[model samples]
Target: MTSPNAAQVPTIKSALKFFKVTSYITGIFLILIMVLWAIRLIWSADVWIGGPDGLIALAQFSVDPSTGEKVGLPGPQIPNDFTTVSLIIHGWLYVAYLFGDFRLWTLLRWSFLRFLVIALGGVIPFLSFFTERYYSKVAEADLKKVA
Candidate 1:
């Protein structure tokens, strides 16, 4: 005895639930990555200037590239370079988070302004954790009413 629109309700509800879960998980991961980035940035003052790997320099004992004499230039600081991999992974995950936001927002027919506000949760460090809790409560309440 369900109308066509009623049939669609479950699908939409499920999608929203998924987004809420995903948003929480991805948000947590992004927060952790941001923490790692901060640690690396604060600690890498001297060598962390070049890039994620710091600056690449020839060893002090190595020959110069242009000249034939033994010389050295800054090279990637040992494991600091490894942080580049984390940076790339976080970037891609954030993109995926955006898609999850789109799906949930589209299904719920949320206003663009609200969507933008929610999207900010991903970038502003620990904001995601707060936003995720707030949205989970909202979604749960709304679902309860529907049921």
Candidate 2:
């Protein structure tokens, strides 16, 4: 007969699934932000439908509070501002990823240091893809033991 703790197998499976989904999503958004940053920093331009040349550079300028006109040479602005939206979305997704990480890590009873390392995956661009693969394998192995 299975041990009492074997019931945790299903919970572990669910937590693993949640962690995997969140890891993939967070990793994708992080990579997207990295690509966009590269475009803006390296090329000094971002894709924009309204940009005269089909691209626009991020700009910050002083504004005349009274006149409501941009001061100095007006800089280019992103017509759609998808970059900001992507960044904000990534921020929130990272939070969700953390929840998954905590849930999985808690269930598996792994070290806090390992948890911190896994957490870095959310911010380190392609790291999530790697961590997701590695840790998921580790979890699956542990799952076999539990079963």
lDDT of candidate 2 at residue 10, scale 0 to 100: 91
Candidate 2 C-alpha error for residue 113, in Å: 0.8
**Residue by residue across 9-38, what tens digits does model 1's lDDT show?**
677667666666666767777776776566
Q: Write the per-residue lDDT of candidate 2 for residues 1-147, one digit (tens) a residue.
A: 223257788998999999999999999999899988887677554444343334554443356899975454233443355576688899999999999999878888888988999999999989999999999998898888876
TM-score of every model versus the real structure? 0.62, 0.76
* lDDT of predicted model 1: 0.60
